[model samples]
Target chain A: MPGVCASSTQSPLEGKVSKVKWPTYLSLSLVAMILGVLLVFQFRVVRYIEQGVSLGRVQELTVELRQLEKEKLKLAAEASDLSAKLQQAGQGQAEAEKALEGELEKARLLAGLVPVTGPGVEVTLDNPPANRGWATSLYVIRDEDLLRVVNELRGAGAEAISINGQRIVATSEIRWAAPFINVNLTRLVPPYHILAIGNPGNLRSALEIPGGLVEYLQELGVQVKIQAHDRLTVPGYNRPLEFRYAKPVVKE
Target chain B: MWLGVWLTLLGLILGVIVGLNIPMVLTKAHAKYLSVAVLAALDSVFGGVRAAMEEHFDHTIFLSGFFANALLAAGLAYIGERLGIDLYLAAVVAFGVRLFQNLAIIRRHLVRGIKRG
Candidate 1:
């Protein structure tokens, strides 16, 4: 360590202190101070340089991402427009096909290529001839059985269905009339006639679906059979559509 | 480097997990088929766009290869899902194929394009 003392005399201090020692100490301290100042400035310079590089890269990536996102949005808009057009075209084609199918079916019936559709199958269920006890009355078809058959026929795409010639409309009720069941307002006895009008193949398969209508009915010892005809029309149910009770209240 | 390869694999896995969880992110009524179709279409379009952009703008082998691999995996996954095939199998095969395909593309780009540059 060099002391801060210095002589003001013009005389050479060489005698008190050697020339090399004082100058050497002064030069070394000056060098160290200069280096300290440079280091502090260097730290700031390095920090700014790093920030510049990082920000430039971030900006570049951000621009690239924005452009990519814009392109994606534009392409998506175009795709949605195309999809909408396709949906409209598909719907139009489906409606036209349905109309043509109906007309063709009618024409086939007129030509005798299809059977006239009328009162569907009549199923009459009677107590087992040997099981003459009142307990055998339980053998009558239950609500679940009727529901299963109706559901199966619906799944098979039956256009119009009537149980025992009673037209099953959207609101038709099928329930037990205490000794016999009334399907679509028509009272039917055991050995029930289920008149379903649809594709015979599909209808039969639907009716015979495993663990479906057929399986349930058979478990109850009810006899089941299907007869297909080209046209079997059931009389329309007389229930009126009720919506007055469901009207929304207006908030003024 | 093998590190790059591993990173790429990790990215793909993350992308898939995130993709599967997107419905949770975006609540909307979307049929699975429709979403899958859209995903496939976007993948194809992105692959093509990336290729075109690379060829026209960057002309870089690595960037183009990444885009191509991403597109292939997305496309195969979509097709498998649509056909009712195992989606995970499709995705796995897609990853391997994409890696090899991209490597080949990179080799070609280096040999045919970068050598002169």
Candidate 2:
């Protein structure tokens, strides 16, 4: 059957080659060409898509967060039960101990160990959607971008600051962990929601300073949204903190 | 046999050139569907070649199959995206499996032809 093409003219009939019909080659060639084009196009498109945090990764983290929340609830219930037992045992405590309890409550509020609510400003940040579909990492929001915003807010007398609902305390950290940022040792995804308790106008103005954090981010193709709110509540620091080496000095 | 292989190579090179010169911009979303469509197209092309070798070549069926399969797969992918399901994966798997099957058939034909020749 394959020899039928050998009888035709322009068959390159010098050899016993299995000559297939020319139509087959022509059609396959066109399709192969389309395939080649798509291969390169898909390759370039994948590179751009992978440049940002993928949806699958975010979903994985969300699953982890849900599991951790369940464990946290279980732990919190156990802690409360233990605290109740201790309070029952410490009934009729001395006046000195009662006074110390009051001091501890004041310390907790000052140390950001409890949630605080007041008039403040909220700053949200995310990289602007690519306009040309070129490099994305170059214009993305970095850890330093977030730090600059936080610093500017604090400089403007923000009493309490929370990033993505993770309270910022003396030991809190805001740093980069490629493809995502970390706050208080917890991974935070964009768009970063930064809430600060302070004079709303002052906090907003601090970020709005010419060539300031907000402006700098905006220039880098980062979407920066700032709004002053009459009331904003910053979450409390939930992670346990332990001081092992530091001790108070005894005063003579 | 060698002429057909050379034509395929030439077509691929020409395709790459045209694809690069073309001003079409493929976003990340469209890129996914393109990959699946490419698989479908390759599958149809191989199926056509196989049919021709078996003495039943029909350009009408081959062309319709190529375009219709790609469009159907792409449409399925779009629906999957809106529904928040990875429905494109089904198209990917089905086309991918058929593509490999067709390639294997072509390889057997080439090997048998070489032995006979």
Top candidate, metric lDDT: 2
Q: Quote the chain B TM-score of every prediction.
A: 0.32, 0.85
TM-score of chain A of each: 0.43, 0.59
Q: Indicate which candidate wins on TM-score.
A: 2
CA error at residue A32 for candidate 1, angstroms: 99
- Model 2 TM-score is 0.41
Q: Write the per-residue lDDT of candidate 1 for residues B9-117, one digit (tens) a residue.
A: 4544554444444332211212222333333323332332333323431212223332343344445556776787756465455444543554455466657766777
- Stretches off by above 4 angstroms in model 1 are A1-127, A130-138, A180-188, A239-244, A247-252, B1-117
User: TM-score for the first chain of model 1?
Assistant: 0.43
Q: lDDT tens string, model 1, A1-252?
A: 112111111112222322223333333333233323333333344444555545567789999999999999999999999999999999999999999999998764443343345433333333444455655455666656777777877787766665665667655788877776766566677656666666777888777779876666667667676665555555554455456668888999
Give all TM-scores, in the order shown. Answer: 0.31, 0.41
Question: What DockQ does each candidate score versus the true complex, computed on alpha carbons?
Answer: 0.01, 0.16
Q: Write the per-residue lDDT of candidate 2 for residues A152-175, one digit (tens) a residue.
A: 999999999999999999998889
Per-residue error at A11 for model 2, in Å?
99
